[model samples]
Target: MHIKERLFGKTAGKEVMAITLTNRSGASITAMTYGASLLEWSVPDKAGKFDNITLAFDNLEDYVTHRPFYGATVGRVAGRVAHGSFEIDGDPYQLETNQETNHLHGGNSGLDTKVWDYQTEQDDQEARIIFSYLDAEGSNRYPGNLKIQVTYTFTEDNKWKINYQAETDAPTLFNPTNHVYFNLHGTVSKTILDHQLFVDADRFVELNEQSIPTGRRPDVAGPPFDFRTARLTSQATESTHPQTLQVSGLDHPFVLNHDANRLDVSLYDPQSGRKITMKTSEPVVVIFMHNGASPLKIANNPIPAYAGITLETQDYPDAINQAHFGSIVLRPGETYRSETTYSFHIE
Candidate 1:
């Protein structure tokens, strides 16, 4: 195993560092400290060739200027907060409406843009990198001073594990997730429409016109939202189902089974014979097909809709607003923890 670090760039007078972790399987993951974001993930294909499967920029400037989350670690809250307003303890708080009418990914200048402290280590067993960030009190109009820590580990078995821990000094909302867009076809030009996906979910959250959750978990056994069984990605997108037309692609949260250490989702690309098995401790997973408009280009290549797939695991969007969904509130003495693992293999 090998771990290396280099000066990536400077953000807000702070130095950003890129750390690379390589395991015995010749698989590697590169992460930057600027946003505590993943820059690249190289895995072996069936042909024994390794290729980066995630969308990445060539420089830090592209990530800073681009609106696409890319491989960012989204925080404060991972998804929307419903009109950017939420009441806690009888007090109303309003957040930045970065996503038009709702608060998206913790508003503008969220944790994804801030510099984080990082530590790296490589042992005979695996290579790991841990990132830590502190959100000051009322930094983003939310109460409490929050401290967050996330660790990324690469094992010899080709498993990538992400562990998150957070605590707050006052009652506040805390939900963080890694927004890593994957293109397992070995290239960004290829769309993931042909990939086979299986999500261990029976119900999915319905969305409104503005992409806000309606606080309903409709059964996914039918309609365009169904993924109860392994199915080709195109089957859902090509249909005229109302939910399918709403986002131009899939972009809703799926309720995950409560079984711990069990597989939550599986994405397989037949073209490259690469498969990814993911397990998470979260209750919901939002799978986005990247159907929105974007001018951001990665590696000098224009990124089009459906170019990548983002499987974000975290608390459901607007959990604070909808008490029935689940509680995302973190009190002063409580600790928040989440873990997600992606095991890579060739089928």
Candidate 2:
């Protein structure tokens, strides 16, 4: 395995660096210091042809202007917090409502937009990059001083692993995920409708019109919600179910039936014969069939809706308010850790 670093661009007067880690098998993953975002992942298909499978911009200017969250490390909390209001040890804290009335993706200036310090390590079997950031206390009105580290490991066996660790100086909320959209066909011009997906989940979090959880975990026994078995993504995007129609596709958080030894999710594209299986320690995986309404472009071409999909593994959204969703609270003297791994191969 080997690693290379190059100047990506300048953002906020700080130089952003792009670090590429290549394994012996010829698969490579590139990450950027800006937002600690994933820049590219090129892997071979059945024909031994390599292509970038993640949807991302070709330059830093687009990332700075569009803020699509593409491949970025989402943080503080991965999903929406109801009205940006939550209490920590009886003290109520209100965050910026960046998305309508909800606090989406850790407020306006979340971890995804921050530049992080990084360190790299390489061994005979793996290449690793660790990005670290310090979230000052009271930033965006959140409590505690949070020190977070996001590590990406590329192994010789074609496994890309993400490990998140955090520590807080006071009571705070911490749930993070990588917003990396994958289109196995290798291009954003192609939609993921034809890809097959399997999620080991019996239920999914119900969301309101505003996309905040309704505190309900609806059973996914039939139709669009049922992805227990491998099914075409078109099955969900083309469905008329209210939940599917609400957001134009599957954007709900499916509560995982966790098993340390089992792979919890898999996505495959028949045409390219590229498959990715995921295992995570987190309790939920938010499957977002990219139904972006923004006028976006990549390679100077217009990006269509459903061009890619995200499998965001993290704790439940708005867990602080939903008693059954479990806790995301990180207090002093406590350390928070979560991990997710993706193994790639030809089907």
- CA displacement after TM-score superposition, residue 280 of candidate 2 (Å): 0.1
- Assess each prediction's global lDDT (C-alpha) against the native: 0.87, 0.91
Clashes of each: 0, 0
Q: How much lDDT does candidate 2 score?
A: 0.91
Residue 151, model 1: Cα distance from true site in angstroms: 0.6
The sequence of per-residue lDDT tens digits that candidate 1 reaches over residues 253-308 is 99988666557999999989999989998989999998864687666677777888
Per-model TM against the reference:
0.97, 0.98
Model 1: colliding residue pairs: none
Residue 184 miss distance in model 1 (angstroms): 0.3
Best by TM-score: 2
Who wins the lDDT comparison? 2
Candidate 1 runs further than 4 Å off: 259-262
Superposition TM-score, candidate 2 onto the true structure: 0.98
